[model samples]
Target: MDRISALRNVEDALRAFEEGDVDLTEAERRVAATLRTYASELDGEDDVFRAVGDPAVDGRVVVAASAPAARERVLAAAGIDPDRIDDEGDVPEFDVERV
Candidate 1:
């Protein structure tokens, strides 16, 4: 499937899981499979950026360099205050392997 379609599937599965319509295992499996396919499609790009957000809230993910400014930009784009990202232990859930 295309990246957009695959992501949509992931989001759907996540929503279902969140609403208790699906089990966590099934939801994770669907997301993993879709992400694997999508990642393969992006095979030759520079993977030098990362963005963090709760998929249960936002379905889209974006990447940015690890530079302080870039990280702040990404956090802001996700509707999170960069200064508060590390404060109050509000770390956003993200997969390190995917990053």
Candidate 2:
């Protein structure tokens, strides 16, 4: 699957879980699989980029790269506009259990 579709699948699974359509275990499994695919795609790319997101905020994803320009490219690949990210402080703390 393409990166965008993979990301959408993750979002859809989370929404289903939140609506009580699926259990946490099922949600985690689906998310993990989708993320693994997404990560593999990123790995194949020449540039180094890391995709990060917070469970607290739905559909909030950020791509970190070696440089600002590369970061913009990563964000674009994920269909995100870098300007939309107001500030670094907007990113929530990583909550291992919640995520």
Candidate 3:
């Protein structure tokens, strides 16, 4: 979807929430879906991925060439330094799935 379309969709979701037509959870879901659609449409050769399994990186959406790259992108976006790990548990454990 185009940027304008995405904005309109998000606005609609917000309006529904304001109008009491949908609950907060439903409105959030609709907004997320619209954003995912917009991101996927704008993604070129790479694919859009969502991070899962870890609290720090969970729900992060990014466009990457591969799953590994996507995870790394999420980590970076979350201010996580993979190489600065103090121990095995220091690194966030998450999986990037194509969205």
Clashes of each: 2, 0, 0
What TM-score would you give candidate 3 relative to the actual structure? 0.70
lDDT string, candidate 3, 1-99, tens digits: 999999999999999999999999999999999987899788478999999988988999999999988988998999988788686587778888988
- Candidate 1: the clashing residue pairs are 49-64, 50-64
The digit string of per-residue lDDT tens for model 1 on 1-99 reads 677798799889999999999999999998988876675455443343444445622333344334454455555666778565665666455432134
Q: Which candidate do you rate higher for TM-score, 1 or 2?
A: 2
Give the Cα lDDT of each candidate.
0.61, 0.60, 0.89
| Candidate number achieving the greatest TM-score relative to the actual structure | 3
lDDT for position 53 in model 2: 49
TM-score for each predicted model, relative to the true structure = 0.40, 0.41, 0.70
Task: List model 2 lDDT by residue over 1-99, tens digit each.
Answer: 687899799999999999999999999999988976665456432433443444443343333444454445545655556577677664443311111
Q: Which residue runs of candidate 3 sit more than 4 Å off their true CA positions? A: 52-59, 65-68, 87-89, 93-98
Name the candidate, 1 or 3, with the larger lDDT value: 3
Point out the higher-scoring one by lDDT: 2 or 3. 3
Clashing pairs in 2: none
Query: Where's the lowest-lDDT run of ten residues in candidate 2?
Result: 90-99
State how far residue 82 of model 3 sits from its true place (Å): 2.4
